[model samples]
Target: MPKQIEDQKKILLRVRKISGQVQAIERALIEQKNCDAILQQICAARGAMNGLMHELLEVHLKDTLVVNQSSEQERSEELQNISKILKSYLK
Candidate 1:
């Protein structure tokens, strides 16, 4: 597990890079670049965004909803629910 501040910094950096990739994609389209190349760029951007979303959700689960369960039973249940959500998202 990462420290909260470090995780935030990583997320922010990814978001910034994604923004740049989006701008590149826009320029590629406006310039009428090759369709396959443009599609590849778009796919890269989409994957980056997906990764960021996954990281953010994981951090949110760790920091918020699953933070205060002191009992083993409660923690186990929370983890199960979290796993289900993650599976759905990844799928």
Candidate 2:
């Protein structure tokens, strides 16, 4: 796991990317791009937003529950399993 500062940096980068995606969508709208093209851009923006959500959720889980819940093997295993589930979910 990384320090909170590192996690924050990563999270912020994702957020920035998501913002850019949204701005692109707005620009497309203003330019009156084709419907299909606009929809594709919307999908891309949605995917970026989902990715951001995924990153933020993982950080929240690690910081809020996994970090100090326990030092036992069971806790570690639980974290790993949850991580796997999350990865599968995003896919």
lDDT of 1 by residue, 24-77 (tens): 999999999999999999999999999997888778677655665467877677
Which 10 consecutive residues of model 2 have the lowest summed lDDT? 63-72
lDDT at residue 51 of model 1 (Cα atoms): 91
Quickly count the clashes in candidate 1: 0
Best-matching candidate per lDDT: 1
| TM, every model | 0.69, 0.69
Off by over 4 Å in 1: 1-3, 68-91
State the lDDT of candidate 2 residue by residue for 1-91, as single tens digits: 4349989999888888888888988998999889899899889888887887778777877875667566678677777878897788769
Candidate 2 scores a C-alpha RMSD against the true structure in Å of: 5.0
